[model samples]
Every structure is written in structure tokens, then in C-alpha cells.
Target: MNKTVNQKAWFLVLPVLLLVAFSAVIPLMTVVNYSVQDTFGNNQFFWAGLEWFEEMLNDDRMWGALGRQLMFSGIILLIQVPLGVFVALNMPKKGFWASFCLVFMSLPLLIPWNVVGTIWQVFGRVDIGLLGHTLAALGIEYNYTSDPFAAWVTIIVMDVWHWTSLVALLAYAGLQSIPDAYYQAAKIDQASRWKVFRFIELPKMMGVLMIAILLRFMDSFMIYTEPFVVTGGGPGSTTTLLSIDLVKMALGQFDLGPAAAFSLMYFLVILLISWVFYTVMINLDKREG
Candidate 1:
């Protein structure tokens, strides 16, 4: 006898579909409408077609911000992934220590994004903050608000501190999912630490590592709050990534049409890159299988 498929599952999914439509789909459509239209002083909208998009495409400031965003994201990924893997590899496997470590690792992720920015903002102050005061006492100039390199370093370090835990946790979960037989097999082969990790652990952790990479890349590309709070995109826009620039254009300058166009383009870049990542991941899975 053939087993019947569940016909009632769609009924259970209908509420979720409605919620997604109302929440994400509706807002996105509104944004698309704004991107292609112009609004006057009295709140009347006129169809502008691709006027804003053309202007944005030719704008030097947008390109600069995009470049900076790419560099920041690259640096963050290069630093975090390897370091996180190392930390995860060294963490205790089981016991109260493991639970305690896991809880501690998750603490940073639980904090609100704005609050994380605020904490780092005050924490980096030169006078009252421990980091600034210590650096100043050592006769080093440590003002992120003035110096470009200093501002970059401050934001990079702040991001590393806030997000590295997420990578570590994902790596840890991947490591934990491995069977003990893999380790025993490696030992029987007289595998070194590097060999064990390279041959056995890395392949097993590939899925979660991809997830970690994707998460980190997306978050880094769209980052605004922490760096905004810490450096305020100061020192001659040295740290002004795309998100910060978009906010400045829309809110600070009150430029409606260009800002809307900028946001749409920005969203498209993210969507395209994320799609590429998904496709590559699918192919990798197929190859491995």
C-alpha cells in the first residue's frame, strides 16, 4: 500500500505565509515603488523611471563607500574565520566547563546591536575608558575620531570582538557533530593535529563553516551601528562604509530620490552576492556527496 502525503500541512503554513507577505513582502514593494518614483514637497509622487539610478551609478561617493565596505568585509572574514576555528578546536569537549564556555561565547550575540555600539563607543574613549586611558598613558595617540587608521583599527577590533564568538560557536557545533570514530581513525593513522584537522575535521565542518562565512559576510557588508557610534564615519570619511553613506544621504541630506535609488542598488548587490554563495554551496555539497 502507498503511504498518503499530508494534505493539511499547507493549512499550517498559511499563517506563516501571510505573516511573511505582510511583513517583508509589503515593505519591500514599498521600497521598490519609492526607488522608481519622485516625491514633491506636498507628498505627491511622480514617476521618475531610472533617473535616480543613473545618477547614483555615476556618483563617485557611492563607489568610494562600496570600496570601503568591501575592504572591511574582507578584512573581517580573513581575521575571524581562522581565529574562530582555532578557538573552537581548543575549547573543552564536554563537562561543566563546556557549558560555561558555550554560555560565555553566546553572551556577545545576545546584546542588541545598538547597545554593542554604545559599549564600544564609551569603552574606546581616551579619557575615562580603560582602553583609551591605557593607550594614552603609554604615550600613544589613540583617538579614533581624528585619525583615519586609528578609526579603522578601532572599528575592526570592535567588530572582531562582537562577532568572532558567532563563528566560534558555529565551528564548535560542527566539531561536536563529528563521530568519535573519526578521531580514532585519525589516531590509528598517526595523524598530527594539523593532519587531523585538515583531513577529517575540515570536511565535516564545511557546512557550518559556509553558514558562518555567509552570516559574517552579510553582517559585515551591512554593518552600520557599531562603527557609526565609534567613529561617526569621521576622519574624512575614511571609515564611511556603504550603509553609513546611505544613511547620510537619506536622513542627513534629506535626499529622497537618490537615497531610495542607492538603497535599492545596495539591496541588489547583497541579494546577488548571497545568491552566488548559495549556488556555490549547493555545488560543493553535490561534489562532496
Candidate 2:
């Protein structure tokens, strides 16, 4: 019953493993090293142990940024998931229009993150931007640079515009995978639209929906470039999420030790929350299954 294993497959993957080590592992190790030690210039470093971690933990600014980060991520999920699913439900399931719709839906996701930010930054300017000028013409006091609420709304809208298409596309794929027989059966059973969705489509889409939720959650939680470019964490740090704050600490103030420590904590927070989301969704899927 003993057959020789194909150990040679490892050779094919070795390059990828090496690439990952060089690209991700090495940089991670450097961050870890920086996090635990303090430097006083002249290429000198001294052990700081967990002092930076403690300081970061106690810092109110970090806490505020974390709160805003969590709030932003939560809002993104709440809005994007439902909207995406609804869009998927309404999208043409087949034919040329379906192909066109797919291409159109993909347009936003195709743009680079920084480019999306820049586009929004210009688009939201009150003096010249179409949206801003129209709002101004209507006497709407919309100023993202000066008003915290407006800044939050603009970023949220921007994110929704940018990422909801991803969720819709995923959901659409899930819908496509469902057997047409199920719809036929539902029709024969005199099932209502809501009933068919609840009893058939929704359950079938659950796996992909979970994926969409997790992806959106992680992306939103770690969001940086777009909001940073659009709002620059302005209106008195009202929109200063964790990533922006981390960059400021690391580069703006050159607090390397603390910044490194903060980054590690940030990584941990993302990892932990992602794990929780994955676990909960898996359990829910299992229960439904």
C-alpha cells in the first residue's frame, strides 16, 4: 500500500517560497527588530523591550484613531454588503448586457487606490469640482476640509463607490453558480421573490457573501491612501484612521521604535479581527449547511 510520494513538486514551489521570504518575511523581521529596540542615531541601538508597546497602548491618540477605524470599517460593511447583494440580485444574469454590466462594475475596482483618492479629491472640491459646485449652487454647506461630518460622508461615499462593485461581482458569481433547476423548482412551488431568495439564492450565495464581507472588512480596516489623499486626516483628526496615524508617527515624526510597535499591534488587530470574522462566518455557514 506504500507508494512513493512526488517530492519533486517542492522544486516548483521553492522559487515562490524564496520570493515570499525575501519580500514579506525579511521586512517583517526588520519591523520586529525595530519594534523592540531604540536607536540614538550614529547606527546605535539599545534594548527598549515593550516600552513602546506600553506607550502606544496608553496613547489616547492611537485609541481615537482605532475608534474611528473601527467605526469606518463597520459603516463600510453595513452599507456595501447589502447594496452589493441588492445590485447583484438586480443584475442581468445572462446575455450581452450581462457582459457589459460586468465590465462596468469592474471599472472602479480597476483604478489604483491612490488614483481613486486623487480623483475624489478633485471631484469633491467646492470651487471647481462638478459635485462640489452643484452642491454649492444648491446652497449645501459641504466642505470636507472644514467639516468633520462632511469629511466622513465623503470618505464613506468614496469607499462605497470604489468597493461595492467587488462585493456585487462576487455575489454575482455566486448567483451564477446556482443551478437553474432550483429557480425552476421555486417557481413550480409558487414561491415569492423574497421566499426564493431566502430559501434558495441567499443560502447559495452565502459562501461568496462571506468572502465579500471578510475582504471588505479587511480592506476597510486597513484603508489609508484614498482617505489620506482625499481628506489628509483633516478637520482636526476626525477622519484620522489607524493607518494614517501610523504613517504620521513613523515618517512625519520619525518615532521609529514606537511606530514599529504600533504597526505590529495594528497587524495583530487586523489578524485577530479577521480571524474572528472568518470563524463566525464559517460557523454560520456550517449551521446553514
Candidate 3:
């Protein structure tokens, strides 16, 4: 049977395709162009083929920033995933309380990124901020502006507070999708709580958990605004992640070629890591299935 295929859907999608090309593709092409070429005054450009990439690869500053970025992302994942799942497990399963909890959990995610940073920046002031004042009263030597450890702790805690709810909500949705029959079967089999979670709920939530992990990984890796506002990559660049370093190179120093190269490499690293994560998770899912 030869039936004519409907081609009308292409028309509807054309705008989005054009928009992506204009927004993402064009800018990427510009970056690539800038990466291999050097510019002087009056918009003059000359080929420097691979020089910038080589320099960036050998730069200690870039490596340090990358290490910090990786560490931050790793810490966020380690803390948020388990914490989010635990919160999800404890949340009300139904009724008005469930609705209320969902709304409350969503509140942190609603604030804009820069605004969240600003809120934390003010909230951590030693003289006036509630957190700082309370800590001071307790004889705690907490000062994010001067102490690297304190700065790191503040950013990590802020991130966990802001994003854990996202993981919880995703896990909750996965939980909601599970049929009651599974629980009934587990109950009939006299499965313990741990057994039920291990043999059923955890498996069911794996798909959403993978999603949560990837989303959190990418966001944390590229994180800029919040930490920048709060710490300004300060305490002697102890918190200077890749994005902040790149911005400093590009705009702060006007090193366009190196910055462009740095950005492209940054993009590639994220893409490569994300691919690995996706591949591993998909394989794990298949093995479990």
C-alpha cells in the first residue's frame, strides 16, 4: 500500500529551525571564526591557525578553572541526587498536602539566577544578614568574602537549596507514574520497605533520575551568574570556574582569540561529558530493563 505522506508539518517547524540557525548556529560559527584568527584595531583579522587553542591548552589558569568547575559540578551531583530522592520519598503522595508541597518545592526554582545570587550575597553579610549574624552570635568565623572555604560552602549550599527541589519534583513525577498494582504485589510478597524501593521504586525512577543528573551536570558546569554575583570568583580566584575565567579573558582582558578558543573548547568539553553521561545511563537502563 502506497499512501501519500503528509508534508504539511514541515511548514510548522520551519520557523523554529530558522530561529535555531540564526541564534545558535550563527553565533557558533562566529566563535569558530574568531578562534582561529586575530584581530587588531579597525576590525582587521589575520589567520593564527591553532595558536590560540595551543595556548589555551597549555594555560595553567584554564586548567585550574576547569578543575574547580569539575569539582563543583561533582559535589552538586553527589549532594543533590540523593537528597532530592530522599525528599521525594518523604513527600505526601496525594491530596492537598501534596499540592502544597509541590508548590513550596517549586518556589526556589522560580527566582531568576542573578536574583538568587543577589539574595545570597546580601543574606551572607556578616553585620546584617540573618545567616551571618546568627553564625557570628555562635562564634563562627564565617565570611565568604575573605575565607575561601566559607565562599565554597556558601555557593554549594546555595546551589543545593536552589536545585534540589527540581530533582525531587522529577523523582516525584516518576513515583506518581508507578501503578498501585506494583505496591500491592510487593505488599503481598511481604517485601520490606528497602526491598520495595530497591526492587521497584528505584528502577522506576531511574529514567527521571538520569534526566535530573544530566540537567544538573550541565547547569552546574556552565554556572556563572549566581556564583559571580555572590563571590565574584574572589578569595584569590579560589572559586573562579571556567565560565568566569572565560568572561574575564574575553571582556576583562580583551583577549578575543584566546577567549574564543577557550569558549569553543569549553563547549566541546561539555558536549563530550554530556555524551558520556547519556551513553552510560542509556546502557545502564538497557541492562536494567
Give a tens-digit lDDT track for model 1, residues 1-289.
9999989878988989899999988887887887788886477789999999999999999999999999999999999999999999999999999999999999999998889888878888897888888999999999888889888998999889999999999999999999999999999999999999999999988988998999999999999988888888988999999999999988898777888899989999999999988888887788888
> For residues 1-289, what per-residue lDDT tens digits would candidate 2 score against the true structure?
9998898888999999999999998998999999989986676889999999999999998899999999999999999999999999999999999999999999999999999999999899998888888899999999999999999999999999999999999999999999989999999999999999998999899989999999999999989999999999999999999999999999898888999999999999988988988998889788878
Residue lDDT tens for model 3, 87-178: 99999999999999999999999999999999999899899898988999999999999999999999999999899999999999999999
Model 1 regions lying over 4 Å from their true place: 1-12
Number of backbone clashes in candidate 1: 0
Decreasing lDDT order of the candidates: 3, 2, 1
- Which regions in candidate 2 have their CA more than 4 angstroms from the true location? 1-13, 280-289
- Against the reference, the lDDT scores of all candidates come to 0.91, 0.94, 0.96
Pairs with steric clashes in candidate 3: none
**Maximum-TM-score candidate:** 3
Between candidates 1 and 2, name the one with more favorable lDDT. 2
Candidate 2 to truth, TM: 0.93
Best by lDDT: 3
Better of 1 and 3 by TM-score: 3
Listed in order, each prediction's TM-score against the native is 0.93, 0.93, 0.94
